[model samples]
Target: MEIIVVIGGPLEEGAIRRWLHQKLQQKDNQKFQFIGVDGGCLKLMSEELPIDLAIGDFDSISSGDKEILKNYAAKMIEFPSEKDFTDFEEALMWVAKSYPQQKIHVLGAFGGRVDHAISCLWTMFRPELQALIPYLSLEDEWNHISFLTPGEYVIHKLEHTKYLSFISTGSVKQLTLKQVKYPLNHQDYDFPIALISNEFIDEQMEISFESGGIIVGQTRDSWR
Candidate 1:
Protein backbone atom coordinates (compact mmCIF):
# COMPACT_ATOMS: atom_id res chain seq x y z
CA MET A 1 0.00 0.00 0.00
CA GLU A 2 1.15 3.52 -0.78
CA ILE A 3 0.90 6.21 1.89
CA ILE A 4 -0.39 9.75 1.23
CA VAL A 5 0.55 12.42 3.76
CA VAL A 6 -1.61 15.54 3.71
CA ILE A 7 -0.37 18.70 5.46
CA GLY A 8 -1.65 22.25 5.80
CA GLY A 9 -0.45 24.04 2.68
CA PRO A 10 -2.06 25.65 -0.32
CA LEU A 11 -4.68 23.29 -1.73
CA GLU A 12 -6.93 23.59 -4.75
CA GLU A 13 -9.91 21.28 -4.41
CA GLY A 14 -10.44 20.89 -8.12
CA ALA A 15 -6.81 20.09 -8.81
CA ILE A 16 -6.69 17.58 -5.93
CA ARG A 17 -9.83 15.83 -7.10
CA ARG A 18 -8.48 15.52 -10.63
CA TRP A 19 -5.15 14.20 -9.40
CA LEU A 20 -6.84 11.64 -7.16
CA HIS A 21 -9.14 10.53 -9.96
CA GLN A 22 -6.22 9.83 -12.28
CA LYS A 23 -4.29 8.00 -9.58
CA LEU A 24 -7.28 5.81 -8.76
CA GLN A 25 -7.73 4.90 -12.40
CA GLN A 26 -4.07 4.07 -12.83
CA LYS A 27 -3.92 1.85 -9.74
CA ASP A 28 -7.28 0.17 -9.66
CA ASN A 29 -6.15 -2.48 -7.22
CA GLN A 30 -3.80 -0.39 -5.15
CA LYS A 31 -4.64 0.44 -1.56
CA PHE A 32 -3.79 3.84 -0.07
CA GLN A 33 -3.25 4.83 3.54
CA PHE A 34 -4.01 8.50 4.00
CA ILE A 35 -2.24 10.25 6.90
CA GLY A 36 -3.71 13.64 7.65
CA VAL A 37 -1.59 16.08 9.67
CA ASP A 38 -3.32 18.81 11.75
CA GLY A 39 -5.54 20.97 9.52
CA GLY A 40 -4.72 18.66 6.68
CA CYS A 41 -7.14 16.19 8.22
CA LEU A 42 -9.80 18.78 7.71
CA LYS A 43 -9.00 18.96 4.02
CA LEU A 44 -9.40 15.19 3.67
CA MET A 45 -12.68 15.35 5.55
CA SER A 46 -13.87 18.24 3.40
CA GLU A 47 -13.13 16.21 0.30
CA GLU A 48 -15.09 13.26 1.73
CA LEU A 49 -12.03 11.06 1.53
CA PRO A 50 -11.23 8.34 4.06
CA ILE A 51 -8.53 9.13 6.60
CA ASP A 52 -6.66 5.94 7.42
CA LEU A 53 -4.43 7.59 9.99
CA ALA A 54 -4.67 11.15 11.29
CA ILE A 55 -1.55 12.24 13.17
CA GLY A 56 -0.67 15.75 14.41
CA ASP A 57 -0.65 18.21 17.30
CA PHE A 58 -4.22 19.49 16.60
CA ASP A 59 -3.15 23.03 17.52
CA SER A 60 -3.94 24.20 14.00
CA ILE A 61 -7.47 22.79 14.17
CA SER A 62 -10.49 23.71 16.24
CA SER A 63 -12.30 21.39 18.64
CA GLY A 64 -15.11 20.86 16.16
CA ASP A 65 -12.63 20.02 13.45
CA LYS A 66 -10.82 17.61 15.75
CA GLU A 67 -14.11 15.92 16.51
CA ILE A 68 -14.80 15.54 12.82
CA LEU A 69 -11.36 14.02 12.27
CA LYS A 70 -11.79 11.65 15.19
CA ASN A 71 -15.15 10.44 13.89
CA TYR A 72 -13.88 9.85 10.36
CA ALA A 73 -10.31 8.76 10.90
CA ALA A 74 -9.62 5.07 11.41
CA LYS A 75 -6.62 5.76 13.65
CA MET A 76 -5.39 8.99 15.19
CA ILE A 77 -2.25 10.02 17.03
CA GLU A 78 -1.70 13.30 18.77
CA PHE A 79 1.50 15.08 19.80
CA PRO A 80 2.41 18.09 21.90
CA SER A 81 2.40 21.42 20.07
CA GLU A 82 5.76 22.38 21.56
CA LYS A 83 7.87 19.70 19.97
CA ASP A 84 11.14 19.41 18.16
CA PHE A 85 9.74 18.64 14.72
CA THR A 86 6.88 20.12 12.76
CA ASP A 87 3.66 18.12 12.51
CA PHE A 88 4.51 17.21 8.93
CA GLU A 89 7.94 15.96 9.91
CA GLU A 90 6.43 13.97 12.77
CA ALA A 91 4.06 12.31 10.34
CA LEU A 92 6.94 11.44 8.00
CA MET A 93 8.93 10.00 10.86
CA TRP A 94 6.01 7.85 11.89
CA VAL A 95 5.70 6.52 8.38
CA ALA A 96 9.41 5.84 8.19
CA LYS A 97 9.22 3.70 11.29
CA SER A 98 5.92 1.97 10.58
CA TYR A 99 5.71 1.58 6.82
CA PRO A 100 9.23 2.07 5.59
CA GLN A 101 8.74 0.11 2.38
CA GLN A 102 5.70 1.99 1.12
CA LYS A 103 6.13 4.95 -1.17
CA ILE A 104 4.98 8.17 0.51
CA HIS A 105 3.35 10.93 -1.51
CA VAL A 106 2.91 14.26 0.27
CA LEU A 107 0.27 16.88 -0.55
CA GLY A 108 -0.33 20.40 0.70
CA ALA A 109 3.36 20.70 1.56
CA PHE A 110 4.14 23.78 -0.52
CA GLY A 111 3.16 27.44 -0.48
CA GLY A 112 2.47 29.36 2.74
CA ARG A 113 5.62 30.21 4.71
CA VAL A 114 8.89 30.06 2.80
CA ASP A 115 10.63 28.39 5.74
CA HIS A 116 8.01 25.66 5.91
CA ALA A 117 8.31 25.01 2.19
CA ILE A 118 12.08 24.73 2.43
CA SER A 119 11.80 22.57 5.52
CA CYS A 120 9.45 20.16 3.78
CA LEU A 121 11.89 19.82 0.87
CA TRP A 122 14.88 19.22 3.12
CA THR A 123 13.05 16.93 5.55
CA MET A 124 13.45 14.02 3.20
CA PHE A 125 17.20 14.09 3.79
CA ARG A 126 16.89 13.79 7.56
CA PRO A 127 18.85 10.90 9.01
CA GLU A 128 15.73 8.94 9.89
CA LEU A 129 14.05 9.50 6.53
CA GLN A 130 17.03 9.33 4.21
CA ALA A 131 16.30 5.69 3.34
CA LEU A 132 12.89 6.78 2.08
CA ILE A 133 14.35 9.40 -0.29
CA PRO A 134 13.75 7.52 -3.51
CA TYR A 135 10.28 6.52 -2.36
CA LEU A 136 9.20 10.03 -1.39
CA SER A 137 7.40 12.65 -3.47
CA LEU A 138 5.43 15.87 -3.05
CA GLU A 139 2.72 17.36 -5.22
CA ASP A 140 0.46 20.35 -5.57
CA GLU A 141 -1.74 21.95 -8.21
CA TRP A 142 1.17 23.04 -10.42
CA ASN A 143 4.17 20.96 -9.39
CA HIS A 144 5.13 17.36 -8.73
CA ILE A 145 8.43 16.89 -6.87
CA SER A 146 10.50 13.75 -6.57
CA PHE A 147 14.03 12.73 -5.57
CA LEU A 148 16.42 10.74 -7.70
CA THR A 149 19.42 8.70 -6.61
CA PRO A 150 22.44 7.87 -8.70
CA GLY A 151 21.12 5.83 -11.60
CA GLU A 152 19.80 5.97 -15.12
CA TYR A 153 16.08 6.63 -15.25
CA VAL A 154 13.57 6.79 -18.09
CA ILE A 155 11.22 9.63 -17.20
CA HIS A 156 7.86 9.64 -18.89
CA LYS A 157 6.30 13.04 -19.25
CA LEU A 158 3.40 13.49 -16.86
CA GLU A 159 0.12 14.58 -18.42
CA HIS A 160 -0.04 18.36 -18.82
CA THR A 161 3.45 18.79 -17.35
CA LYS A 162 4.92 21.49 -19.59
CA TYR A 163 8.36 21.77 -18.02
CA LEU A 164 10.93 19.47 -16.43
CA SER A 165 13.59 20.68 -14.02
CA PHE A 166 16.43 19.24 -11.96
CA ILE A 167 18.08 20.69 -8.87
CA SER A 168 21.16 19.15 -7.37
CA THR A 169 20.67 18.44 -3.68
CA GLY A 170 24.45 17.98 -3.28
CA SER A 171 27.59 17.69 -5.36
CA VAL A 172 26.79 15.78 -8.56
CA LYS A 173 28.96 14.27 -11.26
CA GLN A 174 28.59 12.66 -14.66
CA LEU A 175 25.06 13.98 -15.07
CA THR A 176 23.51 13.40 -18.50
CA LEU A 177 20.14 14.20 -19.95
CA LYS A 178 18.98 12.91 -23.35
CA GLN A 179 16.00 13.29 -25.66
CA VAL A 180 15.21 16.63 -24.06
CA LYS A 181 15.26 20.10 -25.58
CA TYR A 182 18.48 21.02 -23.78
CA PRO A 183 20.47 17.81 -23.69
CA LEU A 184 23.55 17.53 -21.53
CA ASN A 185 26.57 15.24 -21.85
CA HIS A 186 28.27 14.03 -18.68
CA GLN A 187 28.08 17.45 -17.07
CA ASP A 188 29.52 17.77 -13.58
CA TYR A 189 27.98 20.08 -11.02
CA ASP A 190 30.05 20.84 -7.91
CA PHE A 191 27.41 22.84 -6.12
CA PRO A 192 23.64 22.92 -6.04
CA ILE A 193 22.17 24.44 -9.21
CA ALA A 194 18.93 24.45 -11.02
CA LEU A 195 18.63 23.10 -14.55
CA ILE A 196 15.23 24.61 -15.11
CA SER A 197 12.68 24.74 -17.93
CA ASN A 198 13.89 21.76 -19.93
CA GLU A 199 11.23 20.34 -22.24
CA PHE A 200 10.60 16.86 -23.43
CA ILE A 201 11.40 16.04 -27.08
CA ASP A 202 9.00 13.11 -27.15
CA GLU A 203 6.86 11.21 -24.66
CA GLN A 204 9.83 10.48 -22.45
CA MET A 205 13.39 11.52 -21.57
CA GLU A 206 16.51 9.94 -20.07
CA ILE A 207 18.39 11.04 -16.96
CA SER A 208 21.57 9.52 -15.62
CA PHE A 209 23.92 10.58 -12.89
CA GLU A 210 26.91 8.84 -11.40
CA SER A 211 27.05 10.55 -7.98
CA GLY A 212 24.89 12.57 -5.59
CA GLY A 213 21.13 13.17 -5.84
CA ILE A 214 18.80 15.49 -7.74
CA ILE A 215 15.34 16.88 -7.20
CA VAL A 216 13.10 16.39 -10.23
CA GLY A 217 10.11 18.62 -10.76
CA GLN A 218 7.43 18.20 -13.38
CA THR A 219 5.50 21.43 -13.52
CA ARG A 220 2.96 23.46 -15.46
CA ASP A 221 2.15 27.16 -15.72
CA SER A 222 -1.46 26.72 -14.66
CA TRP A 223 -4.10 24.07 -14.00
CA ARG A 224 -5.62 24.74 -17.38
Candidate 2:
Protein backbone atom coordinates (compact mmCIF):
# COMPACT_ATOMS: atom_id res chain seq x y z
CA MET A 1 0.00 0.00 0.00
CA GLU A 2 1.21 3.51 -0.71
CA ILE A 3 1.02 5.99 2.16
CA ILE A 4 0.59 9.76 2.03
CA VAL A 5 1.41 11.65 5.22
CA VAL A 6 0.44 15.25 5.63
CA ILE A 7 2.41 16.94 8.43
CA GLY A 8 1.70 20.00 10.54
CA GLY A 9 2.98 22.85 8.47
CA PRO A 10 1.55 25.73 6.53
CA LEU A 11 -0.19 24.33 3.47
CA GLU A 12 -1.14 26.77 0.70
CA GLU A 13 -4.12 27.95 2.80
CA GLY A 14 -6.87 28.07 0.19
CA ALA A 15 -5.41 25.43 -2.09
CA ILE A 16 -6.12 22.23 -0.14
CA ARG A 17 -9.42 21.49 -1.87
CA ARG A 18 -8.09 22.09 -5.36
CA TRP A 19 -4.84 20.31 -4.52
CA LEU A 20 -6.63 17.21 -3.23
CA HIS A 21 -8.84 17.20 -6.31
CA GLN A 22 -5.83 17.38 -8.62
CA LYS A 23 -3.95 14.72 -6.65
CA LEU A 24 -6.86 12.30 -6.80
CA GLN A 25 -7.39 13.08 -10.47
CA GLN A 26 -3.96 11.89 -11.63
CA LYS A 27 -3.53 8.95 -9.30
CA ASP A 28 -5.54 6.03 -7.99
CA ASN A 29 -6.47 7.45 -4.63
CA GLN A 30 -7.94 4.12 -3.63
CA LYS A 31 -4.46 2.64 -3.46
CA PHE A 32 -3.35 5.13 -0.86
CA GLN A 33 -4.08 5.23 2.87
CA PHE A 34 -4.20 8.82 4.02
CA ILE A 35 -2.50 9.62 7.34
CA GLY A 36 -2.48 12.97 9.07
CA VAL A 37 -0.01 14.37 11.60
CA ASP A 38 -1.08 17.12 14.03
CA GLY A 39 -2.51 20.18 12.28
CA GLY A 40 -2.47 18.26 9.04
CA CYS A 41 -5.61 16.57 10.37
CA LEU A 42 -7.44 19.84 9.96
CA LYS A 43 -6.24 20.31 6.41
CA LEU A 44 -7.24 16.81 5.41
CA MET A 45 -10.64 17.11 7.09
CA SER A 46 -11.19 20.53 5.56
CA GLU A 47 -10.82 18.97 2.13
CA GLU A 48 -13.51 16.44 3.11
CA LEU A 49 -11.12 13.56 2.50
CA PRO A 50 -11.08 10.39 4.56
CA ILE A 51 -8.14 9.88 6.85
CA ASP A 52 -7.28 6.26 7.56
CA LEU A 53 -5.04 7.00 10.52
CA ALA A 54 -4.17 10.07 12.53
CA ILE A 55 -0.90 10.26 14.49
CA GLY A 56 0.67 13.06 16.50
CA ASP A 57 0.72 14.66 19.93
CA PHE A 58 -2.16 16.88 18.80
CA ASP A 59 -0.44 19.81 20.41
CA SER A 60 -0.47 21.77 17.19
CA ILE A 61 -4.09 20.92 16.45
CA SER A 62 -7.01 22.51 18.20
CA SER A 63 -9.35 20.52 20.49
CA GLY A 64 -12.12 21.01 17.98
CA ASP A 65 -9.91 19.69 15.21
CA LYS A 66 -9.05 16.64 17.33
CA GLU A 67 -12.73 15.94 17.87
CA ILE A 68 -13.32 16.23 14.14
CA LEU A 69 -10.43 13.94 13.30
CA LYS A 70 -11.49 11.35 15.89
CA ASN A 71 -14.86 11.32 14.28
CA TYR A 72 -13.55 10.79 10.75
CA ALA A 73 -10.36 8.79 11.05
CA ALA A 74 -10.49 5.01 11.31
CA LYS A 75 -7.76 5.00 13.97
CA MET A 76 -6.10 7.59 16.14
CA ILE A 77 -2.57 7.15 17.49
CA GLU A 78 -1.46 9.66 20.03
CA PHE A 79 1.85 10.19 21.84
CA PRO A 80 3.03 12.46 24.59
CA SER A 81 4.16 15.89 23.45
CA GLU A 82 7.46 15.37 25.28
CA LYS A 83 8.37 12.27 23.34
CA ASP A 84 11.84 11.83 21.88
CA PHE A 85 10.85 11.79 18.26
CA THR A 86 9.14 14.52 16.32
CA ASP A 87 5.59 13.71 15.19
CA PHE A 88 6.77 13.21 11.63
CA GLU A 89 9.56 10.89 12.74
CA GLU A 90 7.22 8.85 14.85
CA ALA A 91 4.78 8.58 11.99
CA LEU A 92 7.54 7.52 9.61
CA MET A 93 8.87 4.96 12.05
CA TRP A 94 5.43 3.43 12.34
CA VAL A 95 5.20 3.30 8.56
CA ALA A 96 8.64 1.79 8.23
CA LYS A 97 7.86 -0.98 10.66
CA SER A 98 4.29 -1.76 9.62
CA TYR A 99 4.47 -1.15 5.89
CA PRO A 100 8.07 -1.48 4.80
CA GLN A 101 7.30 -1.76 1.12
CA GLN A 102 4.90 1.13 1.00
CA LYS A 103 5.98 4.25 -0.87
CA ILE A 104 5.70 7.34 1.38
CA HIS A 105 4.89 10.76 0.03
CA VAL A 106 5.17 13.46 2.69
CA LEU A 107 3.42 16.78 2.23
CA GLY A 108 3.71 19.91 4.41
CA ALA A 109 7.08 18.52 5.46
CA PHE A 110 8.71 21.79 4.70
CA GLY A 111 8.13 25.55 5.14
CA GLY A 112 7.19 27.81 8.11
CA ARG A 113 9.93 26.89 10.60
CA VAL A 114 13.47 26.66 9.23
CA ASP A 115 14.71 24.39 12.01
CA HIS A 116 11.79 22.00 11.49
CA ALA A 117 12.60 21.91 7.78
CA ILE A 118 16.23 21.10 8.46
CA SER A 119 15.29 18.49 11.05
CA CYS A 120 13.01 16.77 8.57
CA LEU A 121 15.85 16.62 6.06
CA TRP A 122 18.26 15.23 8.65
CA THR A 123 15.72 12.59 9.70
CA MET A 124 16.66 10.76 6.51
CA PHE A 125 19.90 9.89 8.26
CA ARG A 126 18.38 8.23 11.29
CA PRO A 127 19.89 4.76 11.73
CA GLU A 128 16.58 2.97 12.23
CA LEU A 129 14.83 4.27 9.12
CA GLN A 130 17.85 4.35 6.78
CA ALA A 131 16.69 1.21 5.02
CA LEU A 132 13.50 2.95 3.93
CA ILE A 133 15.40 5.60 2.02
CA PRO A 134 14.27 4.56 -1.44
CA TYR A 135 10.62 4.56 -0.45
CA LEU A 136 10.64 8.01 1.16
CA SER A 137 10.39 11.51 -0.26
CA LEU A 138 9.79 14.99 1.17
CA GLU A 139 7.95 17.37 -1.11
CA ASP A 140 6.97 20.99 -0.85
CA GLU A 141 5.43 23.47 -3.26
CA TRP A 142 8.50 23.85 -5.45
CA ASN A 143 10.88 20.99 -4.69
CA HIS A 144 11.10 17.22 -4.29
CA ILE A 145 14.01 15.86 -2.27
CA SER A 146 15.15 12.32 -1.51
CA PHE A 147 18.22 10.35 -0.58
CA LEU A 148 19.95 7.94 -2.92
CA THR A 149 22.40 5.17 -2.19
CA PRO A 150 25.46 4.58 -4.31
CA GLY A 151 24.25 3.28 -7.64
CA GLU A 152 23.44 4.09 -11.22
CA TYR A 153 20.28 6.17 -11.51
CA VAL A 154 18.28 7.98 -14.14
CA ILE A 155 16.27 11.12 -13.45
CA HIS A 156 13.61 12.08 -15.93
CA LYS A 157 13.19 15.79 -16.00
CA LEU A 158 9.69 16.80 -15.04
CA GLU A 159 8.09 19.40 -17.23
CA HIS A 160 8.72 23.00 -16.18
CA THR A 161 11.55 22.12 -13.78
CA LYS A 162 14.84 23.50 -15.03
CA TYR A 163 17.26 22.86 -12.19
CA LEU A 164 18.74 19.81 -10.42
CA SER A 165 21.10 19.60 -7.49
CA PHE A 166 23.02 16.69 -5.97
CA ILE A 167 24.85 16.86 -2.68
CA SER A 168 26.97 14.11 -1.23
CA THR A 169 26.18 12.80 2.22
CA GLY A 170 29.74 11.69 2.69
CA SER A 171 32.99 11.70 0.68
CA VAL A 172 32.11 10.66 -2.85
CA LYS A 173 34.81 8.79 -4.77
CA GLN A 174 33.75 8.91 -8.38
CA LEU A 175 30.57 10.71 -9.35
CA THR A 176 29.42 11.06 -12.95
CA LEU A 177 26.56 12.80 -14.68
CA LYS A 178 25.44 12.30 -18.28
CA GLN A 179 22.95 14.14 -20.51
CA VAL A 180 23.05 17.19 -18.30
CA LYS A 181 23.78 20.76 -19.37
CA TYR A 182 27.03 20.60 -17.40
CA PRO A 183 28.26 17.04 -17.32
CA LEU A 184 30.67 15.82 -14.71
CA ASN A 185 33.32 13.13 -14.88
CA HIS A 186 34.39 11.02 -11.86
CA GLN A 187 34.50 14.00 -9.46
CA ASP A 188 34.23 14.59 -5.75
CA TYR A 189 31.45 16.66 -4.18
CA ASP A 190 31.59 17.48 -0.46
CA PHE A 191 27.91 17.95 0.32
CA PRO A 192 27.71 21.66 -0.44
CA ILE A 193 27.16 24.28 -3.14
CA ALA A 194 29.81 22.95 -5.54
CA LEU A 195 27.33 20.90 -7.55
CA ILE A 196 24.12 22.73 -6.78
CA SER A 197 21.82 24.39 -9.33
CA ASN A 198 22.83 22.47 -12.46
CA GLU A 199 20.38 22.72 -15.34
CA PHE A 200 19.02 19.67 -17.12
CA ILE A 201 18.82 20.20 -20.86
CA ASP A 202 17.72 16.70 -21.80
CA GLU A 203 14.52 14.76 -21.31
CA GLN A 204 16.30 12.34 -18.98
CA MET A 205 19.59 12.48 -17.12
CA GLU A 206 21.83 9.81 -15.63
CA ILE A 207 24.02 9.90 -12.54
CA SER A 208 26.33 7.42 -10.84
CA PHE A 209 28.54 7.51 -7.82
CA GLU A 210 31.09 4.95 -6.72
CA SER A 211 30.87 5.63 -2.98
CA GLY A 212 28.84 7.56 -0.43
CA GLY A 213 25.15 8.52 -0.49
CA ILE A 214 23.65 11.61 -2.06
CA ILE A 215 20.59 13.77 -1.75
CA VAL A 216 18.99 14.77 -5.05
CA GLY A 217 16.78 17.81 -5.25
CA GLN A 218 14.65 18.87 -8.20
CA THR A 219 13.20 22.35 -8.04
CA ARG A 220 11.37 24.87 -10.19
CA ASP A 221 10.53 28.49 -9.71
CA SER A 222 6.89 29.55 -9.40
CA TRP A 223 7.25 31.79 -12.44
CA ARG A 224 7.98 28.73 -14.54
Q: Judged by TM-score, which candidate is best?
A: 1
Please, what is the whole-model Cα lDDT of each candidate in the order they appear? 0.87, 0.81
Predicted candidate 2 versus true structure: per-residue lDDT over 1-224, tens digit per residue: 67888888778865555544545665674477889988888888877777898999999877887887788999999999998999988999999888887888788877679988878777888887887898898776567788888889998875535689887766886799998888999987655434788988878999998888788888888566
- Write model 1 residue lDDT over 106-147, tens digit each, in one string: 998887888888888887777777878878889876788998
TM-score of each: 0.91, 0.89
Clash tally, candidates in order: 0, 0
Off by over 4 Å in 1: none
Candidate 2: regions farther than 4 A off? 14-30, 190-194
lDDT of 2 at 201: 80
| Clashes by residue pair, model 1 | none
**With candidate 1 superimposed using the best TM-score fit, by how many Å does residue 134's alpha carbon deviate from the native?**
1.9
User: What TM-score does prediction 1 earn?
Assistant: 0.91
What's the lDDT for residue 81 in model 2? 94
**What lDDT does candidate 1 reach at residue 34?**
87
